[model samples]
Target chain A: MINLLFLPLVIPLATAVACLLAWKNQGLQRIISLIGSFLLLIAAAVLLVTVQQDGVLSVQGGGWAAPFGITLVADLFSALMVCVAAGMGLVVAIYSLADTEAEYERLGYHPLMQVLMLGVCGSFLTGDIFNLYVWFETMLIASFVLLAMGGKRAQMEGAIKYVVLNLIASALFLAAVGILYGVAGTLNMADLARMLRESESSGPIPVIAILFFIAFGIKAAVFPLFFWLPASYHTAPMAVTTIFSALLTKVGVYALIRIFTLVFFAELAAWQPYVLAIAGLTMVIGVLGAVAQDEMRRLLSFHIVSQIGYLIMGLGLLTPLALGGAIYFMVHVIAAKSALFLATGMVLRLTGTTELKKLGGLYRHQPLLAGLFLVAALALAGIPPLSGFWAKLALIWSGLESGNHYLVVAVALLVSLLTLFSMTKIWAAAFWKGAVVNGATDTPLPLSRRVYWQMAVPTALLTATTVLIGLWPEPLYALCMDAARQLLVPDAYIFAVLGVQP
Target chain B: MSSIILSTTIRLLLPLLLLFSVFLLLRGHNEPGGGFVGGLVAAAAISLYALAEGVAAAHRILIVNPRQLIASGLLVALSSGVIPLMTGRPFQSGLWLPYSLPVLGHVGTPLLFDLGVYLLVAGMALLIVLSLMEEE
Candidate 1:
């Protein structure tokens, strides 16, 4: 069904509305959100399959032609992204059933979460630059509320930093869009790509590209502009943080890849060195930040930043192999990272805190959770036979093949080691080491059996996904390679959207 | 802080402002006025009434909960987009009536979409204003 292209955006919007309508009944809201998320996952999967079979698919809104009306196109890259995002949304929806407090539900957590999904999916599927900006704002506003839902002191402080920095990024994005439109006279990405490629004069495009870089870099949490991530990610509820960790930065990276390959492909060579350098720095600094953290979610937050480096590294390499690696790495990281956060959420539920030093003896008390954490943690560290290993291998292989990118490869390897070390630090301190003889451990909070299972199931499911991808990497890897080819050669995408053979 | 002059003026002004907002909403299809500005005018009128009377009276006058208004407005807008899909058109394709109505001119999905935006914006503004005023 061609109309399936709009389902990813529509399903979530409808779900959020349904949740809002059932506001007074928290139980009803939960059921609605869960079903909505499940339906979204199915729709996304169908969309992905349709795209895989049909090549790039584009739909114009309100019966208008592309380059004029709003367009939603799904090539392999976007379809895959939407699929993974919907999967993450489903997992988080399940986890939120038990993880979210009734008060937050009353405060519209379910609807806000669905709105966030809508924004994320819209960003992935939109074919217009200005439309992408609108989706980003939609995601931003939903996340802002989700972050500060409880109005806790730390959340407020964190939300302020998050909002202000993100607002600046949005402003930059808008300015870039305005400038680009002024120069090219079109906001449709395919039209822009064709115009930019055909135009003899390339004046001011580089400036616009750099503006987009900084704007998206802030969202992606690349080296210099990633301060807001760690400052705020841990302050939100774990489920919120999990979704944020899974989708938000990846959206930024996806935008980077999309624009660099499509609209700004010409300027990529001029900007390659800067991107690679930033990737290296982001990886090193993020892991180092993780090593210094004793809090559970905070450590994971830093790791999120570090892993973003690898995604960017793939982009910087600018080869089909490298881009495929980056896409694969994105899927791997979403599963592995979200699992880690969900497990940490479990730890918080049982222990009432995420401070690693104050947590111990989990290996004895809750071996299942400990095991789940270990699997995801090792995956994050790029252990063998795990999704992360293959992701890293592909990136490293491409880096070496690219030649002269050895420094980043080395940084990446070293960062993997450091990531392992940080994971071990968490394992040793929180799970392996004996419980601290403090008031915090004397009386563990009694987690209801249902809640425990609800939290654990999603974590285990995600871990299983990582293990599955790790064990059977061929299908996903092939998809990513095809996606990479589509990205590298933009003519197909351009033609699909505008009905003109570029 | 309630003033008799302000209250008396608002009682007469509220209906006129609301009628003006509807005019703006209908005229938006061909003119500069649209749902967003129209919603703002309506919200401003109601808020002014709240200031003269009280938040409780304003809530009573509104009848429906602002939150419900937002939810329903969103549903309306979404359905407008979906209507074209059933008719074998792309999602959100504007489908207008062949015949133009008196005063309103041509009616279409765009008008319905604008109506949704009108309700949503008005509800959103009122919700914020009422909450903030109640907090004070």
Candidate 2:
């Protein structure tokens, strides 16, 4: 069972190699990618179940002992993250069959996508901070290439912004790691937690903590660091964008949660107010940015930033309920946001544009697509009986329970309302309004029925996942609560990784 | 660069550089030289050849696609890791043979892994350099 912990990392890597081996045959690459994704999903599910049963499963790379060698640990939180990431990988792989062009596939898209999965799953599962940095680099390189694959003028512009900002983040992250090693003398997360808790020296720890915050903050795309996201995300192909929406920022949030809970537990209280302030501003600014956008994808991209604020809010509250709510919110938002992006991709395909002024009457022409978009949109807006509503409810409930956070709670509520308004803004302009008489709008792209099903099915599956989670939030919430508990009490994690009683 | 002097120097230098890179790969286990540095040297050799000759000539000399080399190298590295798994050890645990070779010390999975890295680095570098050169 412990061996299964690394399967999430290994399977995607093997699949990427297989894809690369079959590079010339796009058809073969697609088939191999799909199969690989399915296997990964299964492996992730098994790993999640193993973690549920075993408490925390860790494996040392090359049979090295903990704190001395690289460790891959799968606690409930990492397991849940890996599971969701794998599911998204499979869904996007399926979606790519219809959405990705032959030219893109020929440019090594399939292998790069698997490599991206490998990096994501590796980041989630690694028990070492330096290992996490390596995975982040792997993910960054793959995403940079995927972003710039076509080398279109816009793509080049977007990729340049994306890479420059991300490289800065990577540099800061590495610098922080180096300083941290100088301070703590170890890169193992479990060991660091133990040392930080036991140490009397408070010097430079706070600075290191802040540096980490900034590094991950940029990746998470919080306030004042999110310019690259909207500038770049809308420029990528939709399949690439869909996976990025599901994974990239979430990985940053995951890293923040992991490092803060496990290593910086002593400093979280001191940082709470500032974290809350940042959270509130991120929510307001992101939604306002969305409200100002007329393009479909750019608006959704802004919403990704807004939703990240809520995740930070949960972390700020620092209560188990708040953290659990954040975890549940992460799962909900990935499904909801990916569904929205996939549906928008379909819109882009049918209308040859995602511009609101040029896109109209989708409700009349492709009612199914409109309905798919509406389900995901409503979920994003926190409507009843959808995943987002339950996520928000849990977060808000946790906020109210954690006293003296009323202002941010009010901000959260207002953000939800604004989210709804902007979602409807897309609906009113792109779907409910009359179709424009422009030449591009008049001639919808001719999509084959098979390709249409390929695209629609993945979007539907993701939407269904959101609806299912909303309708039956109990199991997931319970698991998330368990994860939150484990995160708050780091002794179990430390014991699992370092075999030491803290 | 169609300089006769540069091309003649590259022709004489290429075989020696390739041999030196292999030596580096083999000595990497206990020495400063390793797969990464070795691969870089080898890539420099090939890239210099491309500069002296042309990318088309370099491609003809390479025979196999750099992309294929990358894939095969990754496979080799992955298999090195998996070899330990078959023996029920953790992934990437080094497994050595009973006897040592002439120049290469105790033959092991780590060496095979290094070889894979060597091939992959060389392929990746060549791919980048060749493409950029082609664009020009």
Candidate 3:
């Protein structure tokens, strides 16, 4: 029962310990990490199935119920997110085995990666706001270590900016949590949601909500607060960047969606317009920034900002369909974007640089790699029959159904085209053009079969998932719909966490 | 580089600081002092020793790796949660001994969990300090 909920958190933490113990043994560390990640995926899948069958599942810590103690709750949305996060964990662990240097392994890379997943799973599964903050700190600390591990000048620069900005974000979130607890006399999210609704006092509540909005906004990299993301994301190791792209910002978006829907449902009208405007600006600015980038990972990092804009846009529209679309978009983008980053990593591995100006002839040298990148890129641009297209269709249909946001709908279309343009720019420069005879391409050696499988297999696995989800999106869509239904009517979650009468 | 006065002062103060940290850790469950504060106190004591006796001496005193302490602490904390699951209870439930224990009275899983936190924080602080000292 509730033991099931603890598995995801426990597995990673246990693995992290094993990894630390195996610090001198890189091969053993990799094996343990892989097995742990595999177990996490299985646990998450089981949790999702259980929550799907049982509605919402909540477990109280130390037998203390509701507002009295910490809880771990897995509604459909959180469960799905956990499943996706674990999937990323597994893939990144595999990718790291091939890509990370031995020096990093000695410096506790595997353990930190495991701890990072632990924090992510904890964040997605926790039922208390303060617990969420703790999990955020856990994730941030692990990420800080991972980002700065190499101690290169570029890494130090990026890590400093990332560290400073995220510290500000954490402080804001903590301050807001303190104010919220003071106002509501509780730290449990369900209890606060209930209390915030019942008490007709909306004075400090709106101000508190604004603080939360800004806090999560910075984490989510929405419009005005996104400068830190592109600056730092490109500088991390490829495996590190892939996992960061997959889970970090999405956690922020998940927080926004969770709080806005559950706690701030009553105040949607006050915030909807602002959320919408931010979404639109985030989309425009992010893609425009991507278009101007010449480096592969930097451009992809900017695209992360733009895709986040779309996810937030669905929440802004505030309908079941739109929310469903947002959740669907989040999952699709996680898969597609991780695949793209892995592919970019492969390009960097082969060509020794991610600079579009220097990278070329990938199509000639590695057609499979080129094809996988194309699939992810096309999927990202919302091409037909891909996962992104269906996700966008759902959002746009919801937009039209809600009436008179024609401009927003048009902007969504424009962003997709711009996404297409930048992706094609990568394709043309990195794959289609003739080989660049430069310092970056000194030898141009082909990978061995083992090396190819170790590297390409993970990207191929992720790309195949994107294609599979694209071709048969019905099951995922249904899950998103169920998740959306739960968000729209949170009585199930509230009751699950706070009991029937609370 | 160290002064005899500094060394002598630390030799006298370190044991008291460590004793106070243990006192703080034991009283944490019902009082204001907890694992985090106690761990910081212990780390401060270690830092003081490092400053007085040089980092090489401090390293000899701390024979085990700080990373191992962290890992063990986390494992203990996670085990505290998982053990309750075996008895059909929720995570981290306060399972107690049927009889009162000698010296430390009425021991339970919450105390064990706090001990885990204590080790983790102390290890983390030591790791940072040792790494910084190494860099210098």
How do the candidates rank by lDDT, highest first?
1, 2, 3
Instruction: Report clash pairs, candidate 3.
Output: none
Cα lDDT of model 2 by residue, B1-136, tens digit? 5999999899889999999999999889998998998999999999999999999999999898899889988999999988888887888888999998876668999999999999999999999999999999
Candidate 3's residue-wise lDDT over A418-484, tens digit each?
Answer: 9999999998999988878873554566766777678898999899988999999999999999999
DockQ category of candidate 1: high
Candidate 1 lDDT? 0.94
Top of the candidates by DockQ: 1
Question: Which regions of candidate 2 deviate over 4 angstroms?
Answer: A439-441, B1-12
Q: Best by lDDT, which number?
A: 1
Candidate 2, residue A146: lDDT: 99
Ranking by DockQ: 1, 2, 3
**Model 2 Cα lDDT, one tens digit per residue, A396-440:** 998898788999999999999999999999998998988788734
Q: For each candidate, what's the DockQ?
A: 0.85, 0.74, 0.73
> How far is B17's C-alpha from truth in model 1 (Å)?
1.6
- Which is better, 2 or 3, measured by DockQ? 2
The TM-score that candidate 1 achieves is 0.98
Give the alpha carbon lDDT tens digit for every residue of B37-130 in model 3: 8989998998889988988888888787788778877878778887888999988888988888887788888888988898889999999998
Query: Looking at every candidate separately, what fraction of the true A–B Cα contacts under 8 Å does it contain?
Result: 0.85, 0.71, 0.83
